[model samples]
Target: MAFLAQFRAAPNLLTMVRLFTIPFIVIEILDGNFGVAFALFILAGISDGFDGLLARWLDQKTTLGLYLDPIADKLLLSTLFLVLTHVGIIPRYVTVLVFSRDFGILLIATLLFATHTLRDFRPSLFGKLNTLVQIVALLTILGEKAFSSHQFTTLNATLVRSIAFLAPLSAAQYAWIVIQRLHSAEDPPRRSAPKTGLAQISAVEGADPSGSTDRVAS
Candidate 1:
């Protein structure tokens, strides 16, 4: 019962709700209802930001929250990228880059988990920046389509190109960091000398059995 109290916290509940909304947002976007889709997307984003703030302010942070937050962000953003690209609002190249980077990251993460090489690797700054660009691109695309604004369309196109270029660059940076960390972990520290207190005895034994007594006496 004591443990159950932790799960009932406000932030955790909000995070859970955000996860639940991902599929609904995807469905609405696919149905060609940009208005409701945009609304749900905004709601999801707000919930995401609010939950983090709530967790920090109310001291309701949890291990589950840490894991769920990133997963929810990835799932929601990835789905939007795919759906919007499929419908021609988002450029195909942008979606391709986003998906490729995400796929690469997931693959590396899986390999690390399987090999027990990584226990905890938080998102890098580059990765977070990529996500922010993606979110902005998605919102701009949706906005342009919904409101029919030329200015927004131009901005959307610019964001799409920027995201396409940055996605792979940021992904490669993350991969390099992971590889360096993995190598550091795998290569254990080298000792300058055998750390045994019986080194003299072993040396004497190697030299001559009779020398053991002399070495001990000395």
Candidate 2:
């Protein structure tokens, strides 16, 4: 019980640790140490999954965890994309599309927060699917290097193309949802004034300051 309690209290800390591993992974990959880089990547991915599950199972969910998890995932994936692209393993266009979507989302999120219109914008099915595709693409590309087969190369290329197309489509759907929610919140129904006894009394007083007999008195 004590062990579980400690884990629950520090889920976000685990996430931060995962983010820190990203730079090391990039450096290793750049140094032509794919073995260590690949291992670090897998460890990061496993920690990502573990943190979320641990938080839920231990009943230790926090707002910080909610934000940190996605940021960590983005940081790791975005860094890998750039590093892999730099090494000429993955296509540059796919990285561009992935980064563009992430940047656009961040910009929109900032705008919404600045306007005090931010809401609980949970990940949609499409967004989740896009992330899954990205992971598959990255892993497939890395696997191609590790295994070095014609089949892996062909599969990696196919995954790369799929991610390039799907990432933007998912991003557009997210943007549309944001716009719709914003518009709906900004255009609420006009409120009607209440008709109270005090209002009637005020009207009568204005009409006849002498307190002359009004319809109610009659």
Candidate 3:
């Protein structure tokens, strides 16, 4: 009951709605109904934004949401990338790069969690930008197909190239951050020097009822 209760939040329900749209979007894409797919994709994007906004506005953020939100985003985006690649809409290399980075990060995160090395899995700025680039690229492709325009060709190419660049760059940045955090976690704490007799006397005099003066003892 408690677990299901977490999904009762409006933000989480919105996320669920987004997840439900994925299959329909996939079906539309597979059937080459680009216009319908584009509309569903747009709806998914809107729901993604509103879920976050509702979470903050309503104070309905939950731990389940923290995990569910990103998972939903990744599943929808990754699946679309694969499906689009199959249809030759998105280049295979772009999907490969995206998948490689995501898979590598997932492996690293799992290993770190199992070993209890570091648990902070916050996405870096570059990672966020990479996701944004991917979203725009997909939108461009779908819009081009739905509207039957040649103008999108140049912009779509640019967005694809941007994804190629940002994917690896973001992965490298994430690795560097993880390495720094691991080093920080492993580094020993610096010990303070022992207080001199006079300093000890002063500390004792200033001690609180809880005997926090011990903190100054070294």
Candidate 4:
């Protein structure tokens, strides 16, 4: 009963809906139903926007929701990137950059958690920017495919370049953040609390850093 209660919250239920929508969206893509996939993707995005707002409004934020929200977002975005690449809608290299950055961050976060090195996993600004870039890129590609629009051609090309640039840049930023936090942790005693003022605000503004949520987009 205790565990079951976690899913009872409105925000979490909405997140679960998004997770369940992913497979259908993938199937639509595989079946060459780009229009349907596009519609479903938009719907999923709507749910994502609402879940967080609902969490705050209803005071329903849970550890499970924090982790589940981003996992769903990543799963949806990453899977779409791969499938789009397979279908020839997106370039393989763009997907590669996306995967590489995400994998590297996940690897580092895992090590830190396992070793008990750091606890506050906040998303750096770069990570948030990367996530935005990736989202826009995906949406542009999907819209182009669904609508068969040549206008999106130039925009798609631009976003591709942005993704290529932002992926490694964000990864590097995350690396620096980790190093800073580690050093702060090792600080003699009083100089701890690595993030302060603007730094702390930026970290908390985005997804949860610990990769348990989107902020860590790390």
Using lDDT as the measure, which candidate wins? 3
TM-score of each candidate structure, all chains considered together: 0.80, 0.79, 0.88, 0.84
Better of 2 and 4 by TM-score: 4
RMSD of each: 7.7, 8.9, 4.8, 13.9
Lowest summed lDDT across 10 adjacent residues in model 2 is found at: 209-218
Error of 2 at 113 (Å): 1.3
Tens-digit per-residue lDDT, 29-90, candidate 3: 99999999999999999999999999999998898899999999999999999999999888
Off by over 4 Å in 4: 190-218
The digit string of per-residue lDDT tens for model 4 on 42-98 reads 999999999999999999889889799989999998999899889887789989999
- Alpha-carbon deviation at 19 in model 4, angstroms: 0.7
What lDDT would candidate 2 get against the real structure? 0.81
Worst 10 residues of 1 by lDDT: 207-216
* lDDT, each prediction: 0.81, 0.81, 0.92, 0.88
